[model samples]
Target: MQKKAGVGFYVFLVIFVFVIMFPFLWILLSSVKPLSELFGDQAFTWFTSNPTIQSYISVFTIRPFHLYLWNSLVVATVTTVYTVFVAAFAAYAIARLRFRGKAIILGVVLSVSMFPQIATISPIYIFLRNIGLTNSHLGLIIPYTTFALPLSIWLLVTFFRKIPFDLEESAKMDGASMMQTYFRIILPLAVPGIFTTAILVFIAAWNEFLFALVINTAEDYKTVPVGIGMFQGQYTIPWGEISAATVIVTIPLVIMVLLFQRRIVSGLTSGAVKE
Candidate 1:
């Protein structure tokens, strides 16, 4: 009976993984297929006979896709850096220091994230326009950081709280200031968690569409998501080129996650058990 159950569980797991991975697999296959096969009878086929790299070449030559990629890299990198830095300080304070209304403050920070982007975009747009930040990378970065902070803070707070207070005490006895202890001892110990938070924040900022679309309408500042969205021509949609662009943009993120999967898992599971 147990053997049968185990076999069924494995089968279920395989199916689950396939379901999750199917869209990406489809997109990847579609990326290399020719335009004729894409819209022809092979539209729903699993594989193509005549695959071509023309779509990949066209994505760069026909449009400023490389520029869009560069824009996304810059904005996401900047947003991740700023968000993680700010969240670390804020999280460390909440985790280590005794303060009034800490729970309320954390709750408020989380509630800010719960607000729908559509609901807030109007005011945010107006504010950016007033400050002359619209159509700039900073405009997108600022809002991305704002939305990313609550989750980063929350994640970092858990990691910080799990850190041994004895370490901080020892640092204090050794003449370390609060900031010194944070930078030298606590932050180093929390590298896994910080790295995990950074990856998540970077992915969020990279794939963000609504803010990218509304804030930065210029070709120079458009990111990958915006660039992919604008792949339509006057007469027909460029599905082949869109697929190639997607494959290009997605490869980097997939590689990053695979490379750091161990650290991400470690960060998430580190403090789960009592020592």
Candidate 2:
């Protein structure tokens, strides 16, 4: 009976993995196939007789794709760094210190995080325009950090709460100031959670389309998603090139997940189990 159950579990796992991976596999396959084959009547064909790197090459030549890639990296990196920095202090305060209206503050943070981005777009646009920040990296970076903060704070707070208070008290007794302990003890112990949250922030900022599109009208400041949208031809869409660009854009995220899968899982599940 145990053997049969194990076999059943393996079958289910295979199906689940395939379901999740099929779309990416399809996109990767499509990216390599020549346009002649992609647009041909051989619809739904998984493999091609001939594969070419033309689409990948064209993705860069046809547009400022390198600039788009760079923009995404910079914006996402800055947003993640700022969000983590700010959220750390906020989380440490909320989780480790006794403060007034802590519950209220946390509730507000969560509620604000839940607010729809679409609903706030116009007001943000107006504010950025008024401040003369339109079509700039800082313009997007500020808002991305703002939008990413709530969730970062929430995650860090949970991880912080899971840490033993005795360690902090011990540090305090050793003539270490709050900032010193935070830097030496808390940050070190919370690396998993911090890295996990950073990855989430980076991915969110990288893939963000609406704000990137609305905030930066120029081709120079566009991110990969928005840049890929401009790959359209006169009459038909450039599926091959679009797929290639998508594959390129998605590779970094895939690499991040692969590299940090264990850290992410550990961080997410850290506070769930208590001694």
lDDT of 1 by residue, 1-275 (tens): 34546788889999999999888899999989988888867899988888889999999998899999999999999999989998999999999988898999889887987878898899899999999999888999988866889878877888888899999999999999989998999999988789888887788898999999999999888999998998787688988898899889888878988998886665556446444
Q: Work out the TM-score per prediction.
A: 0.89, 0.91
Clashes of 2: 0
Clashing pairs in 1: none
Clashing pairs in 2: none
Model 1: weakest 10-residue lDDT segment is: 266-275
On TM-score, the candidate that comes out on top is 2
lDDT of 2 at 56: 93
> Where does candidate 2 have its weakest 10-residue lDDT segment?
266-275
What shift in Å separates residue 100 of candidate 1 from its native position after superposition? Answer: 2.0
